[model samples]
Target: MAKLLALFAAGPLAALAAEPATVAPLTNSGIAGQLVQLLLGLGLVIGLIFLLAWLMRRVQQIGPRGGQVIKLVASQSLGPRDRLVLVQVGTEQILLGLTPGQITPLHVLKEPVPLADAEVATPEFAQRLMELLGKDQKDKP
Candidate 1:
């Protein structure tokens, strides 16, 4: 076991002793060239990061734009992690119950309301309250 340990230690030492030491002296031009390469590489990485960030911003601004049929009418927060959302698909309006884990359909309108007549964009608080009460009345006998 001692002989095996000595052999293992000697193997690395022998290899190191056998290796030729060829040290090239650093010149000013070689140093300058290396510095230029390093600067260019760093600049390329920074520029790529900036480009990706800009692309992400532009994508966020342009959000889901290709022939989108569903439009969000309104959203009300029920709790910290729960919400009621009114979404319009074509002419039909759907009430959705949203939670942290799942989305559920709370109600679906039988009579489809026209988007132009619905005043969905900027509905007054009184108007919206009346509409909700009217909808509740319709649901009951």
Candidate 2:
């Protein structure tokens, strides 16, 4: 049993003794080179991620098989995080109640309004007021 224990200890000691005499010391240039390589790799990964995101956005803009079936007609903010929206899906117009967690259909219009007519009818009141005020000020000058 003692001879077996001695053999086990000797085996590890012999392995340590056979280790290389010289080990290359780490230099500043080597560390800087590794850092540069690491940064370049990280930058490449980030660039690829951004490129993929941009490609996805471009693909999404091309749209689906049926073209744009759903169009947003108008949106009105009820609160900080709540809104009332009118959406035109195909030939139907739907009023939707939007909240942070839920979206509920409020009403559906019997007669669907045309997109061009809706755009012509809904003028921005604040923008019109601002334009009028600007015109009045210019006239006085």
Candidate 3:
């Protein structure tokens, strides 16, 4: 009978009767802070990656095509029906021709002009060619 009374005295019901329930820890403000931080970090990283990709694409778009590009150095009008253009591309110089509806390659020069031989900032021939090309735009009508 004494043992039964001791067991009853030590019961969880008696403990609960003595003290109210203690509240649990708040737990990181209910996961909202962590979730927001995770989402913010993910967005930042993805935005940066997309920005880098867009920058690379813009850089590629502004530059020339891969391998080599041809440059026209000079040209001449030959006869009434033929037109000639002197072109220099990398290590070779070539003469291209236009005759009515047909196009032809006239010659390939042995020596190419060195980059130092011409001033890029003030190229008279190139300027004239650009003017001629601009004039062609008006003639199209």
As a TM-score, model 2 comes out at 0.56
Candidate 1 has a TM-score of 0.50
Better candidate by lDDT, 1 or 2: 2
Candidate 3 per-residue lDDT over residues 87-130, each given as its tens digit: 77777888889889988888887876555543345467866787
- Extract clashing residue pairs from model 3: none
Which residue window of length 10 is worst by lDDT in model 1? 113-122
Worst 10-residue stretch by lDDT in candidate 2? 114-123
Name model 3 segments beyond 4 Å from true. Answer: 1-68, 79-81, 113-141
Candidate 2 C-alpha lDDT tens digits along 1-141: 999999998998898899977888877678789999999999999999999999999998786845879989988999999999999988899999999999999999998765675224425785578687775323432
- Number of the predicted model whose lDDT against the real structure is largest: 2
How accurate locally is residue 96 in candidate 3, as Cα lDDT from 0 to 100? 88
Q: lDDT score of model 1? A: 0.83
TM for every model, in the order presented, reads 0.50, 0.56, 0.34
Evaluate all candidate structures by whole-model CA lDDT and list the values in order: 0.83, 0.85, 0.78
lDDT for model 3, please. Answer: 0.78
Per-residue error at 138 for model 1, in Å?
A: 39
Of 1 and 3, the candidate ahead on lDDT is 1
